[model samples]
Target: MAFRSFGSVDLSPSECYDMLVNVVTPRPIALVSTVSADGMQNLAPFSYFQLGGTSPPSLMISPTLSPEGTEKDTLVNVSATREFVVNIVTREMVEEMNITSVRVGPTEDEWKLACFTPIASDIVRPPRVAESPVHLECTVFKIIRHGDGPSASNYVIGEVVRFHVDDAMLEGQMMLAEKLHTVGRLGGDNYIDTGVPERFRLARPSTPLSRQ
Candidate 1:
């Protein structure tokens, strides 16, 4: 007979979060910055973020409402300005990113608190992180709101109009994840980075799958 793990394990919320954090291998964390309606800035980190792009080159950041169904600062700002920047989180600035994760008043400058420099962008009033190895300047494409549910979160999508990168962070035409040392958010306050571990890649189809 084959043995099973779930058979003896309880899948409670806390346990599930712990397992997901530790077992997801690694997930890219997005340290997003946005400006509120009154011209105040807000910074927050989200693990529910990832690339949903190409063509127009888009990105997605989700700001989950609390149990009371109130929008987060990031979500509110993005909706108003229709613009924001998605800065990649790296191991070197992991501590700063964590500080930005704190939920505070819109007037509080997370950048000042975290000691990150702000650089002007071509198309957006909001700024990008000078310390980040890569920055994506985006204009809001759309926002999908969710009704009250177990895990409902506001999904904000943006079109990338600009991209910046540090020359040292790239190897030839490829991004060396190990060298970039990007960090990912785990369940709670925990995070992990590229361990310089073994890796592999699969072949890509030259033609669109839909045409095949």
Candidate 2:
């Protein structure tokens, strides 16, 4: 067998990013929405997202600073209002979600740009994407800054205050994944359709398994 390895410090930011995203494989998309202090609404999609914990029902999204070292509108609005909504991206909204990822002026409304219908959120000022099947209304629990330069990240830790799910995608209180048809991000200009027919499941071991 042969292999190649290089120190992370030796790789440029772009190269590091490429390697990370390529290997991460099908990261869940968080279509985050926020409202600026002045009431300007902002919407964006991020794949650097995951569930933090369930004790307080927390989730996190890491928004990286632009190469020019400017904060993204989503980060700016989230910092100001201390609230945002994470709308789950499904196959039906994939194109619009991609559109929202485009760079636009802070004042520009990606909701309108993507032709998405915005419905009022229950507790947060930021509206939820009506087209999305699942919406997690979150309040900022904490903001952790990693670095203060280009490609730096701001990890927004949010508590899910409320959850809104489409009735069609729900079986009582449980959400049916097959019905949701969620989409996931891959390395640049690529995405994985999780709604595809192919799927398999593995049952967890009741006790520790012996090594072969």
Candidate 3:
């Protein structure tokens, strides 16, 4: 079950997109919530987000261009306001979160259609989804737009201003991982729980090893 030739399976973007989602096991789903200049709320889900830093905290989210090659509302708002929230979707809210992923006009509020409560944020104008287990408020400091196509993505680097976590979900000073039960994206419509075994720490090698 291996491709020995490194360059043999030259995957097209479409093929890569499919295989990555399918074979990469599971990817973290970032159900991003943002607000436009006019205060209209927008919601979209992307598996392209990852934690970037710890000191003062930061997050990196990629908002890909739409099929028509224009910036999506999430990208425009992130660029204009330089702010957004990364809502962590759990098992309970999967359906509602998926509903928010439906494409709509910039003037529309996906929150309403999804029938979820939008609560006020502390430092950012964009609100957080009340149903989400965790919410991270962020202010964009950089945008890396890729490709020349109309639908090119913007790799946004955002600084965390505040983190909202449900008190009930915490066990003492640590987060109760089993209780969180976060959902992740797989290839196509498939998904897997963030149910990785236990957290383990591995010691770093004291000396660098020479390459063969």
Candidate 4:
């Protein structure tokens, strides 16, 4: 196979970002919702997200700096109140979630714009998305910043305080992935449907192998 390699230092931030997103296939989307101190709702979708750990059940979402070199609304709100909610996006909610991605003023209500019902959360000030299959109520653990200007990224790490799973999506104690119909991010204006019939399970090797 023929391949081309480019040095990281040789590419612009935008160039690197475009390439990286394509290389990192099928990233999970985090539909994060937060509330300002004055009770304004802010919701946005972030593909640069992951569950950080199991011990404390941490969730991390990285919001890249805006074109004007400012932090995103979700970052600002979480900084002020230190609380937020992660609503797992499903196939049915993708269109509404995309509506929330529109750049709007701080006073704007994304829930209303997206036509999503805001349900009262058990612990967080920010309401959970009623349509979402899973809700993770979190308290800010830490905000780690990287780089400056266009290359900047803010990593908001949160500890999951409460987890709400829809009854229909659960099979015994496990959440069925197919029933959830989760969607994932791809490069550019692309996404992947995880509930398709392509899923398979692999068991880890039973015997440990000796190091060469």
TM-score of every prediction relative to native = 0.78, 0.91, 0.85, 0.90
Deviation from native of the Cα of residue 11 in model 4, angstroms: 0.7
List, in order, the clash count of every candidate structure.
0, 0, 3, 0
Flag the better candidate by TM-score, 2 or 4. Answer: 2
**Residue range 173-204, candidate 3, lDDT tens digits:** 68887778787776677676665533222222
> What would you estimate as the lDDT of candidate 2?
0.86
Higher-ranked by lDDT: 1 or 2? 2
Question: For model 3, what is the C-alpha lDDT against the true structure?
Answer: 0.79
Winner by lDDT between candidate 3 and candidate 1: 3
Query: Which window of 10 residues has the lowest lDDT sum in candidate 2?
Result: 203-212
2 against 4, candidate with superior lDDT: 2
The worst-scoring run of ten residues by lDDT in candidate 1 lies at: 203-212
- Tens-place lDDT per residue, model 1, 178-208, is 6677776554555666654323221222222
Instruction: Name the best candidate (by lDDT).
Output: 2
lDDT of predicted model 4 = 0.85
lDDT of 1: 0.75
TM-score computed on alpha carbons, candidate 4: 0.90
Give stretches of model 2 more than 4 Å off.
197-212
Q: Which model, 1 or 4, shows the larger TM-score? A: 4
- Worst lDDT 10-window in candidate 3: 203-212
lDDT of each: 0.75, 0.86, 0.79, 0.85
* Tens-digit lDDT string for candidate 2 (1-212): 79899899999988999999989977899999999999999899999999989999999999999878888888888999999999999877777787787777776777987899999999999999999989999999999989899989899999999999999988899878778788777777677778884333322223222221
The alpha-carbon deviation from the true structure for residue 152 of candidate 3, after best TM-score superposition, in angstroms, is 2.9
Query: What ranges in model 4 sit over 4 Å off?
Result: 197-212
lDDT string, candidate 4, 22-42, tens digits: 889788999999999898899
